[model samples]
Target: MVFGYFSNKRREKMLQQLSDSRPNLTRAEYVNRLVKKGFNKHQAEIVHDVIREFIQMDNFSIYPEDDIHKIYAVEDLDDVELIDVICKKLNLREVVQEDIDELDKTLKIFNAEYILTLTNHISV
Candidate 1:
């Protein structure tokens, strides 16, 4: 439908903007940067994978500081699905209402680094 076309076009533009805002590091570089910031290698990789999965953008161009809310509009995103995927991929316990509520609280100006923090609080 016409609405779908426009929505896709808008999404593509937003993705380009997001990509242009960050340094294009290789996956290894991204992981290293995260490790330097104190995330373990496994945590860094999981965060990268989650962002790459949700944003459909090259992880190389996505940095820890990137605002997730800007990259994907909150209203348009399925928070439950996102949280579920993160939990599943991270081998954390299944998503619960508290997890959803916690995510909602952090949704404002949330960045990639916050994902790492969130996972830390959620049980494995």
Candidate 2:
């Protein structure tokens, strides 16, 4: 009797886990829900598909950094660091950052570095 009781309890617990893991909703039941809410099957399916696609989030696993955390600062930083920070702000798009960084790096090397050196060398 004890064994049977433990077995039943284990089964109930397992079933509860499964139910929590995935909401068990059949397509027909979903359709019925839509119909009651004044949607035909075709319309409901279209709307459902769009919602599902949005929720499903099928995309490239490699997100460009920005989607995770945003970075905002007005200062000077190296190219790679700037790219990573900008990617964090721009939803991880590296291409734009790469182009901008190239221009920034070149400009710094050609003129800004000289200007900074001169400014520092001056005495008050």
Candidate 3:
């Protein structure tokens, strides 16, 4: 069978690992942990960048009003704007069409419904 980008078991394992390490960890720290766990430097960096962008785009914040505001703000992002934001948040160099495609694909794999809600301005 042709599995998705990440197999289900691997996905679950990664989620568990992230959950275990999330507390008291910064983005860089978490990425470092992933690197130590056998993720390559590039993979770890992409994972870090994507996770941080996901956190920023999440509808839940410290305050309910902030959550609502964030949802609306994120809903306004076009694909290019979204990519730009993710790239800026990640401090990535040499972002290209392939990078954006990879980001979009990864996000879709993370949560298909989320792409519809957050990126209504672009066709995914």
Query: How does each model score on TM-score?
Result: 0.72, 0.28, 0.28
| lDDT at residue 112 of model 1 (Cα atoms) | 56
- Between candidates 1 and 2, name the one with more favorable TM-score: 1
Candidate order by decreasing lDDT: 1, 3, 2
Off by over 4 Å in 3: 1-22, 57-124
Candidate maximizing lDDT:
1
Worst lDDT run of 10 residues, candidate 3, spans 60-69
**Model 2 CA lDDT for position 101:** 48
lDDT of each residue in 1-124, candidate 2, tens digit only: 9998997577556545644665555446555665664544654444334333422323211111111111111134433443343333334334344454445554444121222222222211
User: Per-residue CA lDDT of candidate 1, range 35-123, in tens?
Assistant: 88787788788777777777665533766666766666544356456656877887887666676578668665566566666677786
Considering only N, C-alpha and C atoms within 3 Å, which residue pairs clash in candidate 3? Answer: none
Error of 3 at 58 (Å): 9.0
* Model 2 alpha-carbon drift over 4 Å, by segment: 1-23, 57-124
Q: What does candidate 1 score on TM?
A: 0.72
**TM-score order of candidates, best first?**
1, 3, 2
| Model 1: number of backbone collisions | 0
Cα displacement (Å) at residue 71, model 1: 1.1
lDDT on C-alpha atoms for all candidate structures: 0.70, 0.37, 0.41
